[model samples]
Target: MTESSKSAEAVWAAEPSTLLRVGPHFRLSDVDPAATPGFDGDEADGKRELRRTNSELADLQERLWAESRFGGERSVLLLLQAMDTAGKGGILRHVVGGVDPQGISIHAFKAPTEAEKAHDFLWRVRRELPAAGMIGVFDRSHYEDVLIHRVRGFSPPDVIERRYGMINDFESQVEQAGTSIIKVMLHISHDEQKRRLSQRLERPEKNWKYNPGDVDERMFWPDYMDAYQAAFERTSTDVASWHVVPADHKWYARVAVQRLLLQTLREIDPHWPAANYDVEFEKKRLAAS
Candidate 1:
């Protein structure tokens, strides 16, 4: 086994979800974005392991799709939230994108449209949910309403306060309806973010990714951290726990997310649906033809 696979097995076979889970009294400040918790591999190993695991992830995904075709209601929703240059786009492309696209649904939430804003915060979110048997990915999700809204003072204090409970309740409802949610926060350090932003500006191919607004948001880093801590405290629950992955090293982040996803799908353990037709009869019919 590769070191990356060993890293995954160590986490999976031992405590499973405990390593990355957000526990009560969890402090966001203590986490080092450059640290790869529970992983024993370097960058090269991580990339190799990701490639090795892609086939398995795809297999499990197909099984889930088959189960849904046979009337199963289980599905997965991967919710990714992060600061700019934190690699949400890379996760979508490298990790989740390894699976079959036919069985996956991806939606990236931006600022709400007038129509979306007319209703409750979750109205647009609810409409974008994946159906039974599909894997859903939200690049930036409902949490944005709380994160940006809280930091920018777009909403009143009381309004922001209430969203925590609303989000928890909404997630619980989604969980109860057979959708397993993997809520991830890709924790990137302030310096690393700056370096990445600078890289985008320096590289001709990546110049399009440079957003002036991101630099403005950096000024409110401390406030965003506070808002995230508040969100984790209020919303991370037994039904739908949050996993914070250190994302300074892009390879490690991708492997870690892929491992978490593999763990979830393994726990779900969906199998291929049994064939409905009689095998002997079909064989005899084919011979006659």
Candidate 2:
């Protein structure tokens, strides 16, 4: 590895302790979108670190898969929640994309269909939970019921308030059942969001990504921030803690998330299972064949 590569690895390797960690006292407004916590390196370092982290994550994911095939029940779930244009898609593309598809599952939750709306808010979400030995990515998750519903008044105050506890209970149950949860909130400045939205309009290829309604939603930026604060207060729990990732610098956000995944997987420490059959016998059988 080059000097830069080594430095980057060191930075990422220490992230679990050095990075900003969300807890009950966490406040969204206190985070600086421009700040690159736990990583003092520049964009070049971040890019290089991302490559290394991706390879490590891919290897870990494969190990987790192998362990499951041999009867391990543990898995990982990465729940990503962010405002529009806050780099969730970028993280999915640049970070999670490096892992094996069979070992990872991605679910992008949008406005619920009528049939989905008929059931409890979490019904659709529960159905999509990742199985043993896989990494599940929720592009937008059950938090939307609280976020959008709270912001737009689609649900009454009591209902919105109740869903928070429900979400916490749901996550706790899933965690106890062997799925490790890593919840992340991508933090970006209002100005940064506007710039990204403008870019979407300016570039022909990005036109499809832009929604005029996003401008309407921007009108409620403060409301959304308040909603997010409420969410962190109510739903960020020990079983499924939230990590607020500063996302003004896309490169930094991507690398930070990669580091977070590495940390989570390292903690899980999925090992290769011993062969159930006799290794020597299998080797002899193969030789004979």
Candidate 3:
């Protein structure tokens, strides 16, 4: 096994509260991350869950398309966080990808650039904020203020403390502007992560995604866990809540993501756009020529 995988395996076997990858004062062991309680998605189960998840995702995408066409008033912003191999991409591909591309966008934010560091941490985030009548997704998000920043000592302790308050207010402002936030943390066993990471490294198509630095991050599981716990404690609220998604099996993660998205879209009640007869008439006329 690769060194990264081995590190994840150790964390997987450790007690849940020992790891901190997402929110404040939150521990993986405290709650059930399963979409279906008592679920087990070993190899055979993975296949079954994936099929169900795919159908659900397709259906929701259809709904989003219909809503967008109908001139809907609401917008949504979905946030996903996890350790490496947490299935963020898989969830996006299966659940939201088929939705009207014009109405949805995916932004996967990484470490700050030199320009990003010059301004307040929230500046880069504000630039990515979505407009009205659209769905925006963050593969990882500003909660990084509390998770990664705290772990790596990027910010002073007091500054980090202030950020939690700022984030809560920022989310509230977004809601007032007709955007809702839905956050998900993909929870995976360290063993499963090792397995998946190995698969990615071995596959020629996925080799480009494998990074050596990822292993270094893996070594500080305890520090990572502490950061996540603190972040979750401060940011989780009714307006912008966080959901822990068990991701040992990617299929299950996709399904949970689908369900969360469908629910959010249902809440938004996006209206489909009305048709204009002259537009179609002009199209047919051009085709005849």
Candidate 4:
């Protein structure tokens, strides 16, 4: 097996939670991502798991949409963060793939524009915050302020230190305003990432997805890993907890996301809007005529 595979194998064997630093002094070891019994291979297994998870996600989402129709008092936000090839795209695809497009909004944060930097870090993020009863997803999020910016020395040490508290308050306010935040860190082995990158290079259609810069970033895996550990500890809260999913086996990652989303949506449990037919009034008018 490759190093990534070994990392995953090691993770599976780690303490109850493979990722110990994910939550509030809580290890994420409690999660069991081994493919369910009778499941197929890694490739086909994900598809099968997707089938069941999508159905439940769709049903719950439909309820949220109908609830939103009448206006719910609350909403949800999901943040996806991981190293490249950690399966964020696939998680978004499989987890929210069946959700109502109208009730769900996805925002991807890329290199910032001058306008974004002109305002506070949370300024750009606040605009896309989900409305009541809606589900908003960030492919990457404001955590970059602390993660990439800190690691790359984009900001001074004092300024970087200031952001940790700022971000905590920022998320806390959103939660107080009725938007529950769910943050996920997709963890994968370095070797697996190399494999995925190589696969992209060998495939003609996937050439566009290949970025030479990604390889450069991979060189500093230790830095990014440390950055993540710090980010999760400082930012994860009772209101905005982080779920770290192993991504070396893409199937396992998908299953973890699937379960998490289903649980969150069920917690929201928005009711369907009541239909008003008014057929009785119409029939009386027709009879009189």
Q: Which candidate is the best by lDDT?
A: 1
TM-score for all models, in order of appearance: 0.94, 0.95, 0.76, 0.83
lDDT of each: 0.91, 0.90, 0.70, 0.75
Candidate 4 lDDT tens digits, 113-153: 99999999889899999888788999998988888887788
Comparing candidate 1 with candidate 3, which one achieves the higher lDDT? 1
- In candidate 1, which residue pairs get closer than 3 Å at backbone N, Cα or C atoms, i.e. clash? none
Lowest-sum lDDT 10-residue window in model 2:
11-20
Model 2 lDDT, residue 64, Cα: 97
User: Model 4: clashing residue pairs?
Assistant: 16-29, 17-29
Residue 41 CA error for candidate 4 (Å)? 9.9
Winning candidate number (TM-score): 2
Model 1, poorest ten-residue lDDT window? 8-17
Candidate 1's C-alpha runs over 4 A off are 1-16, 284-289
Clashing pairs in 2: none
User: Model 2: how far is 203 from its true place, Å?
Assistant: 1.4
Order candidates by lDDT, high to low. Answer: 1, 2, 4, 3
lDDT of prediction 4: 0.75
**Which one wins by lDDT: 3 or 4?**
4
Q: Write the per-residue lDDT of candidate 1 for residues 43-142, one digit (tens) a residue.
A: 8878987888899999999999999998999999999999999999999999988999999999999999999999999999999998998999998999
